[model samples]
Target: MRVSSIYVDGYRRLTSQKINFEDGTTILAGANNSGKTSLIDLLRVVLGGDGNLRAEDLSASARFDWLMSLVDAAIEGEDCFRALLEDENVFEKVPSVVVRIEVGYDPDTDDIRQFADYLMDLDSEKSSFYFEFRFSSKRDGMIAAFSGLYSDIRKAVDDCNWRSANDAEPGSSVFLVLQAKVDAALVNCSKPEVFFSDESYSNVLPMSTDKSFKRLFNFRAVKASRALDDTSDDKSGELNQRLIAVAKEDKNWEGVISKLPSRVVEAIHDLDIRKLTTDETLRSLNTVIESISSTNGAKQNDLFLDFHVTEDHAVQMIARAMQTRYLGAGVPLSEASQGLGYSNLIFLHLEAESFIRSAAQEENRYLVNLVVLEEPESHMHPQMQSAFIKHLLSRVNEIGCLQAAVTTHSSEIVRLSGIEQLRVLKSEEAGCRIVDLRKFHTEEIADKPAETQRLFSFLYAINFSDLLFADRVIMYEGDTERMYFQALIKAHEELAGLRAQYISYIHVGGAYAHIYKPLVVDTLRLKTVIITDLDYEKESNLSSFEKLKPLLSTNATLNEFFQDGKKNSPPSVADLSSAISADTGVALVPDTELAAVAFQMQPEGYARTLEEAILATLLDAPVWTSLTKKKWKTFRNESGLKFSIPREPESPTITQIVASTSNQKTDFMYSLILNSNLVEAVPPYILSALRWLDS
Candidate 1:
């Protein structure tokens, strides 16, 4: 049997979230504070973890409602309060942390008797059972005790108010004191309850105990803050203790233990320690001790010292002296001297081995084994992080019933794990939303197979999984645009807030920028700005000397953006340029508020690409003169080519100069950034896009 899915409600940030699991492994990935840890904690608690639920474990709204329910019940008098406390269906009415686990099994193969009592569904084809765990008040007089405490506090507050109003005495502080007492009493009465039920939870089976639930599922976790250090005396000592426990469990170690005493005694005898006692210095010391005893009138009480090595003592000594050492460096070094990364990796392997061994034991075997690894990428380099998931999966595959769930923030691990195994947790004001990418792709892109294939291929080729964790995204055309935008964001003060935000810049180019619309806007719901060039083509093969009348955009993204029911026809260049120049290129993505597109344009006319647009923008700035001088010196010195420097910014010679450097756009942009500050030379369209993203 395996856990197919988990539905959590009213648990710390997870108000009403359901997470689906892969049969083998599920990668829970999201940004910090997105309820990844809360989900893990929920799993642990529901699966018989020893942690007790406190008031803080409830969500902010749940906690408020719970307290308000008690307060309202108190205001209605003792009879109403008693009724509310005794109601068996109180959990359904009040907001409390509840988790429903759905476990799927093959009736033909699995042990039916283990989960026979939990089978609420009658259909033979149905292979899943549900178990609900919830927080509730203790029923054995604890509820009555809590009720009495709350009622007493309510009466005390009423009397205090009456006294203050009648006598004008200082009785206002009495309410705060009584409220603290009630809050403490509530914490003392809270407990967790477990029940068997159907999928919708309308049909609940007989009450279940925590021990029975523990027998069904086994859960273990490797927490993110492992506190793994080299000091053997610290928490690292747990490693030694675990080694000892595993060694004692092995049957072969019985014979080794029986022979240890004899081996220790034989080795000690070979050391010849009695020779030290026979030395002249020891003899003189013994003679002095005897004379002192005689002078004190002690006839047969002379004290003497001797060296002894009992077998039991030697065996105990050897056992306590055990230590871990690294022997690959030709000489052994203590574990304390090794690096933290290797130490953590070793610790992880040992933990997995221990859990596996425990689960495989005959008496401790469980129906399902769950091993959760939180932030396994800690202290690991990129290469190691990328490979750790596969290594862990291979190790856990030994047990056919085992399932591993890894929670990570590393993009390398996410990229390697693939989207099919991902459960992305997104934080919202109400709680969290868990997005299963497998279902998302199947439902959202079910009709568009070609686009689906193109999307996955593009994602895999660029390894753009890091965008999954960004606050927003900026998709640009090429390397030159990426380089210039990065430099500009860093150099300009107006864009300083963009630096604080986590923005992922992706190079999608003009042809495939539209391909990411579904994922960026629909799945991730990210605020996205796609910057593409308006590649204008000549109207009718006009001669270079003659003026070009009309132009058309060749960019697929812009064409699709402005496609007005026209087939095989791109948007006119004049219309696109007009929108860009007027700062009207921003359009909300269909059914989304966070995504838009920005294309290149010049105020007076159409500029073909980012390179031309930047040059045209810089024509009126002083930096343009500096760039011309630098371009002249660079070409003359590096290529031994002579060219006339353009004196007038509007001259056709300047346009020729911009066109000449098209082949080396990246290198030219790099040189331009290194020599001149282009903060004032930012193109209008690009500036609008950046400011929109910043806002």
Candidate 2:
């Protein structure tokens, strides 16, 4: 049996959230304060033998609602308050934090006895059951106590109001006083209870105890704020502790090391310390006790203090002495000498091994094992993180019943893991939402199977997980644009603030930008700006000096952006240019206010590509003369440069010059960035795009 899903309500920020788990591992990823830690805490509290729920565990809204319910009952008559306290139905309506675990099992192959008590379905087709951990009131007398407190609060509030109405100063705020009292009362009255139910939660069977639940599920968590250090005084010998536990369970050490417990006692006895000092000390203590008894006129047997070591004490002493060491260079290095990163990694491995061994033990093995690794990338670098996740998965697969849920903020781990196992926790005003990326793709892009596969393949090849954690994204054309844009952002003061934000710059080019539309706009819902080229081609019959009609563009992304509901025909360049001038060239993605597209525009006469646009913007600048002589001389002289034609035309136009030197765009961009003030030469179209992104 495995836990397939978890439904949480009124727990911290998770007002009502459902998270589905994968068979092997379910990776929970999100920004800080998005409830990843809260979900992990919920799982641990429910399954880790500590079901204690404090007042702060409940959501702010839930707490206020529960408090108001009590106030409303008090405002009514005594009978209403009694009904709210004594009536089962009325009391059950009070708000409480609940977490429901849905377990899935195969009746034909798996042992149903593990969860037989929780089975609520009668049909054979159903293979799942629901078990809930609810934090609520579990005893009587809560009503009378609450009533007296409420009455005192009302009297205090009335006195304060009268004092304020007169000349005297008012006391503390009424709401604050009431809230503190409510929180205190709740902490004293509430407890966590376990229940069995069906799918709809309409039928519930409350378990008298959590013994069955504890026996069925084994949970372990590796928290992020671990007390890990390379110091001898470090109290958190987590790795060493797990090592000892696993070693005690190994049969190979039964007769050899396991006998040390008895040997410890024998070794202490051979020391003869009891005869040397302990006997004398006990005789002195007995004399004092007898003297005190005689003086009090009470007959009592003689008493004395003695010291002896038991097997349990010996075992504890051995455990405390154990330490982990790193072996290399013909010498053993203590954990204090090793890096914390490697130490943390070893700690995680030992934890996984301990969980696996515990489940595989023959004496009283648990039916299912679940491990929660919170921020496993805490101290490791990127490459180590990637390797750790891969190896962690291999270890998980060693046992079929083992399942792991990892919460991380590392893109490297996310990049290495399968998308099907990833769950993104997104926070909203109301609560949090867990988005299954694979399910989203299967549902949203169901019709484009080939495109979907291609998109994902390209994304993985380029580490697309970076975009998953970005607050905003900039998808531009080739490396030349990427380099130039980076330089521009750093050089321009207006756009320099982008350095402080989490912005992912993706080099998707124009041909593939349309493929990532659904993902960036629909799935991730990032604030994205796609900067592409307006690849304009010359007509066949146009004269050398005549204006080239901007009738068509070769860019697939640009074409799609300006499709305007047309099937095969694209908008003419004139219309596109007009839209650009009117600031309507880009369109916001439907239902998302953050996504838009920005492409090249004709700053002077019909600039085709980014190169043409840059040259056009720099045509009238003061640096034009030096730039032309230094960079454009090859095209102007037509002597040694390669082109479509063997002999390049002399005195080439700006368009012809750009076409001839297209292969050297990167070098040209770098030259301009190094030699000239390129920020002033930035095209108006790009400036507009950058301004929109900044906003």
Best by TM-score: 2
Encode model 2's per-residue lDDT on 1-695: one tens digit a residue: 77889888888878777888887888999878878898888777788876667778878776666665655555564566567667767554555788888988877877776577678988899999888878876546466556567575446445555322122222346656776787777767777778899998888888878766766787888888876797766667667777877776666755666566667657666987656665776778778878888998998676543566555675578678977777889899776776778888887877777777766666334366788999999889998898889988887876777789899989888888877788898776777777787687566655567976777676655947887677778888878888877888888888966777678888886687767777676777777888877665656444432344356667787676676455466766654555563654454544567777676654533555677677677664211112333355554243232222113554345666677677788777777677445787787777777767877
Residue 166 shift from truth in candidate 2, angstroms? 25
Residue-wise lDDT of candidate 1 within 226-247, one digit each (tens)? 8678654443554565566566
Worst 10 residues of 2 by lDDT: 621-630
TM-score against truth, every candidate: 0.78, 0.83
Clash list (residue pairs), candidate 2: none
Q: How high is the lDDT of residue 442 in model 1?
A: 75
- lDDT (0-100) at residue 191 of candidate 2? 75
Q: Residue 63 of model 1: what lDDT?
A: 50
Cα lDDT over the full model 2: 0.71
